[model samples]
Target: MKHITFYLDFISPYAYLAFEKLPAALEGVSHSVTYQPILFAGLLKHHGQLGPAEIPGKREWTYRQVLWQAHEHGIPMQMPSAHPFNPLALLRLAIACGPNRFVCETIFRHAWRGGADAADAARVQALQQQLAPGRDPASDDVKNALKQATNDAIARGLFGVPTFAVDDKLFWGFDALSMLRAYLLGDAWFATTWDAATRPTSALVRPARG
Candidate 1:
């Protein structure tokens, strides 16, 4: 069976939205979903990109858009009061879960739906204990796994959370989920490749206007 690698960061509202809808979006499809947690800050820094909240216009738009999307999807959502919170403990807790869907969902819901602050180490530890009793998130093994998974994501050319990867092809954002489903179902459009030989030079450069 084909597998889809879902790269996620708990701090991203977009990632939370994607997590809620992805299961139904891929229903009846023969594929496995692998949830991999990575640091969103690391990806942003590596790619020299800013988070949505970093910009003025984009910040307001992002909050409004996420609320609209949650309503459209019929899922309960509340924006966490804290923006740009650290996700280290959250990611490590996911690593401790080791592909447990229940744990992933619980954490996502707690952070996004419940509007809980995930950056608090004590709160994260409590959540981890609820999901996996007596599990140590700060263990060397769990820490190493998260670090390696993050580096692997960077190596795969991923610059954002909620990215889906099937083999070598990558689809980014919640909006791309439909395109991903089409591609997975063997759509001919996905098979087509752009050829540089057919490019129009006129469109490549714009004429200067006085």
Candidate 2:
């Protein structure tokens, strides 16, 4: 059995795409996914990295690239020009996955498939009603859980959403998801195909400080 911890926030389109495709990526594999919601903007700031929207060139290239990839992979996506960066409501729904999983999956589906903002109070509340009636958005437990999840993210070295930690391995970005897929599909399948340049060590490692 394998376990993959998926740290995600509702703010990233890449996160949405990854969540939508993860089921197929894990097909036939004995695995469990734990969703941890975090503040992506803070994560980027901590690492001295720019968010996708802040990087002019990268942001432009990303939109085109994502569209192309979506076409090729049959994944539906639309990069919201004025996308909101809040993840509070989304995190609440995620942490509510205490005894059941369908609620979490439903939220992901609304955000990823419907292109809805999972963080919005109105949007999330409506979705909650449709999927799981009696699950009030204003509930005390839900509110507390969301706050705790956000705080937990800060403690976990998480600065972004859609950050996946499989066992001791941490991976970020949609571009690296294929690497995760390869890892889960037995050693032989991914060993030869996995690219080393994208690995965590290679991606972030730099010269020592003086």
- TM-score top scorer: 1
For residues 5-111, what per-residue lDDT tens digits would candidate 2 score against the true structure?
A: 78776667777677767787778778898766655665776677777767778878866776777777788766543454565566555555441346556665566
- Encode model 1's per-residue lDDT on 24-70: one tens digit a residue: 88887789888889888888888777899899999999999999999
lDDT of each: 0.83, 0.66
Lowest-lDDT window of 10 residues in candidate 2? Answer: 92-101
Q: Any idea how many clashes model 2 has?
A: 2
**lDDT score for residue 161 of model 2:** 68
The runs of at least 3 residues in candidate 2 whose Cα sits more than 4 Å from the true structure, single-residue gaps closed, are 96-101, 112-122, 132-144, 154-156, 185-210
Q: Count the backbone clashes (under 3 Å) in each candidate.
A: 0, 2
- How much is 82 displaced in model 1, in angstroms? 0.8
Clashes by residue pair, model 2: 8-162, 43-159
